[model samples]
Target chain A: MSNMPTESQHARGQTEPSHGAVRTHVISFAIMIVLTVVAFVMVGAGMAPWIVVPVILALAVIQVGLQLYDFMHLNQRGHSFPAFFITSGALLGLIFIVVLVLWP
Target chain B: MEAQPRLVNAADRMELGLETSTLEGRNKVLGFWVFLGGECALFASLFATYLTLRGQTLNGPTAKELFHLPLVGVATLFLLTSSLTGVLGINAMHQGRRRSLLRWLGVTVLLGLAFLAVQVVEFITYVGEGFGFSTSAFSSAFYALVGFHGGHVAFGVIWISILMLQLKKSGITARKAPKVFIASLYWHFVDVVWVFIFTVVYLMGIMGI
Candidate 1:
């Protein structure tokens, strides 16, 4: 517990974020908007369900990765436990949905 | 654990922002992550129920008939932008800029409110078209899943509003930082779920699948 500060200092380096940090966030926001717009446009154009469904689903997964890694800072050091918990929970939920929907 | 003697003031030791500067704060964050994990399973079950029963409309208005992509798309924009603002708020908190944090959080809360208002209007419009919760199994499941997510957004709006008042009062201390951080985490989780909701529920629903 006493050594926590030094560990955090080493991980985070500084209290103030650099210009690059802010830029990364802005770029991430841009990517999310692009992904969202693409998904909406594809669906709105009346594309085939077989293509639209899988493509939009894949896009959703990619956007979620951005949220988790960039927006939520799960990419930061010392997030292993947090990542573990969320990943396990998401996986468990996925399994639950698959099992229930497939066999019910 | 014995209380360690403070050689420096608590605020001065905040090199990693106030949230991770203390053992207690770190634990609070960790504990909240655990709670979010459980939330995932909880929402997943509701999603599973919706997926299975969505085809059982039984003469009621179906998903294709009920969902409007333009409206839902606008709502998604609101929430997604709010999430961006949320991360910016956390960034301000890390920079020790209290006013920036408050302003960003205020934007987040307002956007959340806007999303909820759209949802309310959508629900009301559905009911006007005889798509009430009791209309069919599909209607029930739809409301149960989407409404639950809306309920989370509403709760987040309220929670962040109160936290804003506290941040105004205390000006972002170690104690308050974790609260704000966890609240932002919750807000982000809600947005993540909505990503799925818009993809699985609205878009797919509009496709008549």
Candidate 2:
């Protein structure tokens, strides 16, 4: 086993002074707000329901993507496996919902 | 990174505790994910109920009449920003910045309170317009979806208040770190739920559902 701390260790690394993370997190928040506003407008404009639902869903998914990739730092080396597992589970759960609720 | 003496010191002290604890960081993470899985099941049941009872308005205002995009827009902002503040709090804890951690957590709780306050106002308004919990299927589903989320915000505020006290007594020691981490994960999960609420409850409601 390597003596060096892995990247997931780095994510959970306490006592480090990496305040730069705050800045990146703030940027992600700003983007999420902007996207949320856009979604609000698109849905409010009396757009076709079919078009609007998918658009808003896509935006919501992207915001979740941002949360995972940017703030959670799921792209870090050792974190990827857990991230993938979580994403797959969420996706499967979503599919189950659609199949059960909306499927013919 | 500048030589991380503080981290080295904390890690040194933490290695002993890490061995003794059954609920260390990784276990906490895995356990919380399992908890989230359970919550998913809960929401699925609610969603099924909502699908069944959505259109039974029983002479009450339907979702199209009751949902105001502008009001919901503000509420979503508050909840989403609170999630951001929780992220900041966790980042502060990771950096061992106790003051920033507490400050951000304070902001998070305050924003959560604001979201709940707005929800209360919305509920009051709707009820005044002849929509009560038992009024119709729409009212029931609306209350269930939105009130369930409101309950989460209430729980989050209480949870973070305890964390604030913990921060005061213990600072961001390794013991407190995992607690803060789990709290923020809960916050994020709440945020994710609101994302769906915004989409299905507000947006779809306004779409004449």
Candidate 3:
């Protein structure tokens, strides 16, 4: 029983966020905005259609990462359950989409 | 003394607010994230339906034809900015700055309203352009996927508004902090979904598959 991890370890004051961490959020928001604009420009520029699709998709994925990590603080500890469930949901959603769309 | 149940020192309170300090707050906060995960799956199914049905305009204006770049761009900007403001609201919550939190949450809700307003205009415009709900399979799918998201935004706006009112009426004590914090999290999740929608639906639609 002594070897087991204690819940009190995660209790108050243990996981308090540092004061300087807000900068990462500001930087993340800037990057997301820039990426979104780049995407809009890439499409509106009338470049090769299907070719640009991947670029925009990649950009969208990056913005999602920023949202999850920077803004939502999924980067912090104690977020494993939230991360696990959300990722599982995303994976399941992907499978459902592939099946539904690819089905004849 | 009103005999506060848990008296976290003021300095420590900012860092470890209601959400992380109390057992109920921590549990509910984690539980809410899991609940949102289930919601994500629900939206995923809708997205799949939309993906399959898109571009099958069937004598209607196609996506490349109907999606106005400027309007969607505006909507996207509004949503992303709302996400930023939500982060600010959380920062204020962590600082125990009640007035700043209220201001930020108010801005967040206003941005949400703006996003919804733009969406309503977009839908109305699309309908006027002969892309009404029953126009085609693509129309139905677009409305369903995007409207579901819009429905969520509407609900979040109402949720945060009520939370804001509560905070204003009752100052930032222990109990109200967690509710406000959780509502901001909900708002952020909505913004994340908007990011995907902007990319997959509007931008990709403009690309015409």
Candidate 4:
């Protein structure tokens, strides 16, 4: 990236600091709210239990991703460590939960 | 060559937590991330334990009986909005808007306090409903996970309060900027935990999953 042409570098600089990028967050917030509503509807609509559960869970994953990537600025540069460590911890937790659930 | 402008007037804009990308600010932020990493592991274990014990109730009120969705839904709105307010505060910090920063942060703090108030009420309601901490395995796990999260939120409130005081007195000096940034991150992390709680514990339980 350092060796990039000045043209691209200038473009990158323009979009970088990104306080103006908050519009993305507003949009993300909208999507998250919609997703939350959908999740509630899915569960409360009295559909088949199996179908509703996975659908809610899937919407939740999207919301989590949106929160992490946009709201928390995990998608921003210079946050590699925070992103890595956070995901690692979550991964560890998932492994443990799976093991415990499957344990006889 | 990247012109390293060391100390771009620490008294001026403390955006990247410093004028220059000094190792001090970098290390501080890095160290805080490392701390959050450990925090994740800690919370993960709590979550896992909760999941395991969620069904172990010995004739006590099950999750379906105890969880009131509307009340939790309101609490969710508070915390979720606080998370957004926190993002605004952080944006203010980045833009070097001191007054706006304080205003946004103040709003964030207020929302967090409101969330805590609702949580305390919820706990009281649960206890009154006979879902006290020692009532059953499910009760204990529920308290352990959600209660510990509430404890983190409490600590975050105090932490941000002190940071706000420091910011007010010192302005956006490098000495305090990193601290403020980390505290903001901590607040967001707390909200993330709640997202899962709202899902796995509340929504799933509501679905009888």
- Which prediction has the highest DockQ against the true structure? 1
Ten contiguous residues with the weakest lDDT in model 2 chain A: A1-10
| A1-104: candidate 2 lDDT, tens digit per residue | 13224523533433353667788889999999998998889877889988888888899888877876765555543343446556666766676667667752
Decreasing TM-score order of the candidates: 1, 3, 4, 2
Compose the digit string of candidate 3's lDDT tens values, residues B3-90.
Answer: 5423432233334544665555666778888987998899899899899989588998898898899999999889999998998888
Which whole-number lDDT from 0 to 100 does residue A25 have in model 4?
Answer: 73
Across the candidates, what are chain A's individual TM-scores?
A: 0.84, 0.74, 0.82, 0.78
* Tens digits of per-residue lDDT for model 2, B1-209: 78875354334433222211223655575567567656766665666567667778989999898888888989999988988888887776655678998999999999999999999999999999999999988789879977887898899899999989988998776557767777787888788778878887788888875
Q: State model 2's lDDT.
A: 0.75
Point out the higher-scoring one by lDDT: 3 or 4. Answer: 3
TM-score each candidate.
0.92, 0.84, 0.89, 0.87
Task: Report the Cα lDDT for residue B5, model 3.
Answer: 28
lDDT of 4: 0.76
Candidate 2 chain B least-lDDT 10 residues? B13-22
Query: Model 2 — TM-score against the truth?
Result: 0.84
Native contacts retained per candidate? 0.64, 0.25, 0.59, 0.38
lDDT of 1 at B108: 100
Recovery fraction of native interface contacts for candidate 3: 0.59
Alpha-carbon interface RMSD for all candidates, in angstroms: 4.6, 6.3, 5.3, 7.1
For candidate 4, write residues A10-52 as lDDT tens digits. Answer: 2233322565667877778788778887877776676898887
Residues B1-209, candidate 1: write the lDDT tens digits: 66643423233334345686667787888899999999999999999999999999998998998899999999999999999999999999988899999999999999999999999999999999999999999999999999999999999999999999999988988789999999999999999999999999999999998
Ranking by lDDT: 1, 3, 4, 2
Superposition error at A7 for model 2 (Å): 15
lDDT digits (tens) for residues B28-91 of candidate 4 = 7778778877877888788789888898889788988788788888888888888888877777
